[model samples]
Target: METVTIETSDGMPVAGLRYTPQGRARAVVVLAAAMGVRQDFYAAFAAFLAEQGIAVLSFDYRGVGRSVPVAFRRSLRGFQADLFDWAERDYNAALLAAKAWQPDVPLLIVGHSLGGQLPGLLPDNHLVDGILTIATGSGYWRENAPQLKRFVWFMWYFAVPVYTRLFGYFPGKKVRKVGDLPKGVIYQWSRWCRNPHYVSDARGRPIRAGFEKIRVPFLSISFTDDEMMSRTNIDRLHDCYRNARMERRYIRPSDVQAARIGHFGFFRPQFRESLWRDALTWIEQRTADRNQAQSAA
Candidate 1:
């Protein structure tokens, strides 16, 4: 594992780690984790991907993680809401960086939750072979409210915005209570919560056009009982990707007992091998088909 930095088109540096195999690889897989987790959070996943002889690039999005250039500007009363577009630029830069580093290999993207929605915004080709997203969603926010409410996490969207306006950016140190975030982070996030376009289906909908343009083969996987929202977004994706070979898997919690997993527990010490086994199985199978085609061509 080597530390790396990918500078996006807008000049923001995305901090990440890249893992390489002993020799050349046929393809590259770029992974995005839930929320805005740093590359280190995905260390196990990257290691396994390297073992499969596939290069992996996992980075922290700007304004979060180890990425530089923090957005300190808050709206005084709130944030301007436009800086959200910068997130897209970071995604583009990450993709460009992957291609730049290994110009000859095909690329596949694997995103979790919000990370899953990003690849849809990029141009597709032989350079990008396929996409796999786990616990991902479409633009529907309404479906997630039930769980968000049950967990008292709803305060994040409903109350945190108001708090940030008065306190500037709240520090993580003072967050003795839940639902508190940095002033800029909460403000920008609240804007995203309202925009569903960045996170949901966009098939000719008045909302977002980016999703309508995602035509690559996609695999959306869901646990039978995810601690978060149900697979509404995944279901919506299955419906919208009419032209792509889209598949969904709903693995039960008992399947979890057999799998011995919890939400976000896949890479923990107890479950690491099980996760590696299952994940590599999927990557190997899907990636094998892709490799054969490139070889035939």
Candidate 2:
């Protein structure tokens, strides 16, 4: 893997890592990370896909990992980053970089959690060939698992607001939450999670309309043991992409022969043989199908 810098349309430079295949490449895969998760978290998965002949790009969204600006490193004082900036500036920059890197090859996204939802919001999303979503669901407290619902409510209504206000930013890392999150991101995320429909509710009709523009094939994987996302929650989130060809699959711990497969467990190195291999197969078949269609035309 090699480190590269990607410049967003707005002129901000973000850090990225590229994994190139040994020989000919089948496709270009973008590893879109979950909120507050660093790009390094996806490094192993990206390397695995690269070995399977796919060129992969794993990047940190602005305000996280190596992508954090020098100015914000000291403190988030006066920093005004938000979720919209994540979708518009960070993810867009990464996707644009990936697409430009291998213009002729198929461009695909392997999105985790919040990463899954933002793809539809990309204005140039038509350039993407397909998307695979993992453990992504509505962040609404009401849609969380029954056991976690109350805790989620407390986190949203009390913890997030109070903590963010007290610290100027969410001290997620210190609290052992997602990661240390920017104040703007945590505040906007809190607003969405508090709403019954999550992002759809907060942004309303215009955002829903943006989702309708997604026409690519989508494969969404949900874990039954994920305390954060119930099946209903996953469906509620994916439903925003009304025009997409979507397939939702639920995986249980028993199916994977594991004691537990929670929201974040899917990307663990241990699952590389079982779950990761299947993802490669999906990419291969999808690429073949697209090629055949193009040839037939």
RMSD values, in order shown: 4.2, 1.5
Give the clashing residue pairs of candidate 1, or none. Answer: 75-78, 138-200, 138-233, 139-200, 139-201, 169-183, 170-183, 224-251, 256-260
| TM-score quality measure for candidate 1 | 0.79
Model 1, 1-297: lDDT tens digits are 887888766565667778887798656878776654555777877787788788888787664556634454231223221223434666666677787877777677877776775565554323466777777665344555355536434545655655565576534335543222345555544454445443422232223355555566777767655655456645764554456677777777576466534346555655456655676666667667866887899
Clashes of each: 9, 0
- Which candidate leads the pack in TM-score? 2
Across 1-297, the per-residue lDDT of candidate 2 in tens digits comes to: 999998877787889999999987899988889989999988889989999999998888778889888988866655667888788887888888888888877889899999997886777777788889999988888879887896777788888888888889888877787887889889888888777767743454235766788888888988999988888889998998888989988999888789998989999888888889888888887788778878999
Top candidate on lDDT is 2
* Local distance difference test, each candidate: 0.60, 0.85
